[model samples]
Target: MAHQASNIPWNVLASNLHWSELKHPGHGDLHLRFKPDQGKKLHYFVEAFIRNIREHSYTARKQYPEHYNPPLPEEVILDDAVVCKITPTVRRWRAQRKHPGFCRCGSGILRSEETEHKCECPIPIPPEERTAAAFYRRYEPNRCYMFFETNGKAFYNLEIVKTLLLYGEMDTIFRVCAYPGVDLRTWWSMYQCYCENPDAGWDSLCRTALLPYIALNVISCFPETWDSASGKTNEKDYRRMRIYQYMLKHCTKSGMTTEVATHPHRQFFGIADGQFKRYGTEFRGPGLHIPYPYGLMPLEAFLNWDQVVESKPAPADIPQVQWILHSKGLPMELVLEIMAFAGYAPRGRLQVPHDPFHPENREELAKYLRFCWEVLVRCDMMAVALGMAIPWRDLVSNTLVQLLSCVPRRWYTIPDDVDHPESYVFL
Candidate 1:
């Protein structure tokens, strides 16, 4: 005998289902149920709910910018107090899930629903944890708690605000909470805190907030999707590259000379006038005369127009290498090493010294000597042994003496044109 195929229950078959209120109160009351069969199909439902809540909250805040207040108590400072309370609650909730009874047959069936309800519930500091001392401490005058009362309104969603506070770090909270359409006042407050405190971890937060937004505005000209030979590039990636290129072009146009961002000591010897003043043998005694140009020459040459133009991809085509090298503050030796590894030779020949006694020749040699000094300064002896594996000390010393004689005297002295009555002439 032929058998009929059994129909699957709609609720059981669907991945996600939502039930709304019943329309009628009688025996045959109508109910609205929405179910999504595929997981991806539920994306719209989730997105719509999130968007609706966000829009409603934003609109409400806008309607009454000054009067619309957060749900924080007047006595509590949202930043400190909320974080203290919410952190323990989240931890307890997590711990409860790990409890043996939480997953047993009776409670397990309803566990997920209960957990969801708990997440949506108002968070409070447990009575046991809230001692008289703690309360008194929280209410202490002229503390960070006072600012929380005035600033609590900046955080619109209580749940998100509570979650952020539970993280303990103020900068982390700001990053997760402050996105596009978030209140600028809240962002500004966090930004000021970062500026004042100057923590390294907050750098990621600052970059996310400032750079991407600026890039988006500038890259709106391009289509949302762009095809490349390898694959399609997303809008965000395309915008980032465009911003990088724009910055490179701007730096080039402005004639901004690249300096070692890390080693300011190296920069002290790069410019013609600055070089002689800092390291000239005439300015200091013989014992004070260090052989090297204090380690700055290679970086300076790499930054020069001649080297940048020569190292182009197509013999004349200016690539972004110059900008990259400059911005990263990578040393010339390292740059050359990278180029050699990549099968490219830096174009310019190291100009050979003709007359060793000539001032110009000595200057050129000094520049080379400075490069060696910089290498040593950047890496220790062991690192040099492991990496470069060369004897640099002898070479560095030899170059130093040759360059010292050429250090300009005028660089160390006051200008001849200056009319100072207090000036004393040294005969």
Candidate 2:
């Protein structure tokens, strides 16, 4: 007995040790068995020990409120006591039938059907805590872990996301990916529920956040040489981008349809109808409803009705960049287009996972060219090519300043004889 006790692993004898040790992967091995009669006894002991520790932790958190160090079974005597309590009593219970109406949480069985109980069992150790290092152990180095808790809440947890991105079933991934909230677990649960019943309505807000993440993820499929037009093209990037575009389009349409159908129509203001009609006859027509677009497309691809009208509209007819002025609700598409045009290809798909933004689309390409020119003028990059700075503040619309930031620089004045190829790259 003494030799067997001495041979027991340090991890099996303690709890407050490193969590890695407490959750030692080999703890389930039967090779560590002590006695033939005690078959699987150690496994039962460890589980019961853990359950007790969690219960104690909950009691401390609730009762002490202000100050409570979670109980530890690190002490040798405590481990001995826990081990002793589990083997005979817990093992005997296992031999007999499980108590009927036992709360699956491992809490005591329900007292009676009429009696109410809150089932004060502890919350599962959050994935952020349970599997902090699991991602590094399992995934490629380039994979980004962006779901860490900010403030007290996490929109997504690493484990569930890893599973969804790398190994989840196709249908499940699609369903969960469309969930609206930040919580991955909730997204997963809602996804399961949605799968079980397809008639339920979707939550539109999910698309607003999910699209960008999907786009960023697809970027990982791009290779190191992805940005260069010359080197070997990564077929994987192209395929993934195409898939992302299709999914995003489908998701946008589905979400939009649901939103439109459920949205409550506004009642016409009867009292003000006569006064409103004096200013415009358009008020007398059917209730005005602007159809929402599928998704925010690439900047250049986005339609500008005022600019595209059959009669060439004046430049001043376009809508002002009020979002920039307000410094709120900035469009993700605009930022993505800026990055694309600026030649700043993101590192891996994980860095900028979201829907595909096509530069090749005629409208997008035209916009890209215009923005490229605007960027050159605003940054004074053209001055380097011209050999002199041209002040055209009046000619350039002042509102353009609101959309693009200008950083003043004199580097363009480098002497013609300067031979540094590296320094001229930015110019």
Candidate 3:
């Protein structure tokens, strides 16, 4: 009868029994399953199970904040249990799931692990205590760990200590220690003694601080290369020392040796001193010029130019000439002419005959030259090269529409008007 009632298509019984059965697998199954009509009850049972699991996990994390400590290793134990719970279900479903380890709800069960007899309940730890323990581990006393100990004290203080060690200046070290606000006085005194008598204490202080101080420029002193017994300097050390001397000399220099003249309109466009004589506008070199009447080109038209040029037939071995044209907002014909002057070709069949005198294919060459002007104006390269900062989008759109308009009327074929005269429009 219990089993028969469980199978009935209803809600009330489904919620009371089947939901509890799903949560505690160890608890005897209610010998119940949900029918289509009992979906609402089944949903309630699932929701309750999820809510209970989340609450339990949160409670665990709140309990064990110092979970990674050696003796307890609470973090490791909790992690293992979580793996057991989540991994089996994930594998069974053939789906990937991120493991949610430890309860974080402040219930303090973070340190608990289940035993054969029973599961250990959550125990909470104070947040402040955990933070102090972590800090101690990072900044503990060690020669190699200077970065943490110094903790960004003023650069001058660090440099003073570094300089003293490099020059064997023991008395100066003692004098500096007499001043206020310096921590670690014992270590400083020990280091000073080591400098005066090399054999007095362990050589650790000199080894730890000496080389790094020199490398960081805290010590102006340089190491001597001569070996006392051999009476000759080590060649390699001599070479490296000389390099540093050269660097110091150059670092003191004041200004540039020569000045180069540039075009007023373009930042990067400049003529060398010699070339300035021929092209100089006023006294400062050639004026930066834009091929297009306007300042920019359309991005779409630029892309079209790139595609069309790439598609044109050319010799297999010879490199192809590439160009771009742009118009800020002017007629495309003007932009095309500027491109031709700049050495680029415009799209469409060429009217001029191939000039044998020219090394390039004259027809293709003309198109390439026009193309270059198109790219400069359209891409706003002229502005960029000359160091003029202009908005990129407006430049691209204006240039593209202008270039499209410049296409020769003959190049665009209108569909036959016999079929639909209204549909065809000439540019």
Measured against the true structure, the TM-scores of the candidates, in listed sequence, are 0.19, 0.18, 0.12
lDDT of 1 by residue, 1-427 (tens): 0000022122221223211123211111111133233323333332332243334334433332232222222223344555564554443222232222111222212122112213232333334222222212111112342323432223213222323322333332233222323232222213213223311121222222222222222222222212244232432223123232222222122111111111111222222111212122321333445333222122223234222322213222223564577568888778767765664532221222111112333454344333322222222221221222222222222221222113323211223773642222211
Off by over 4 Å in 3: 1-146, 154-156, 164-172, 179-427
Deviation from native of the Cα of residue 423 in model 2, angstroms: 52
Cand. 3 TM to true fold: 0.12
Predicted structure 2: lDDT: 0.24
- All candidates' lDDT scores? 0.27, 0.24, 0.25
Expressed as tens digits, the lDDT of each residue in 334-419 for candidate 3 is 76566456544322222221111122334443343233222222212212222333332222222212222222132122356534
lDDT: the better of candidates 1 and 3: 1
Q: For model 1, what is the alpha-carbon lDDT of residue 129?
A: 25
Name the better of 1 and 2 by TM-score. Answer: 1
Clashes of each: 2, 15, 54
Write down the worst ten-residue block by lDDT for model 3: 258-267
Q: Output the TM-score of candidate 1.
A: 0.19
**Ordering by lDDT:** 1, 3, 2
CA shift of 426, model 2, Å: 45
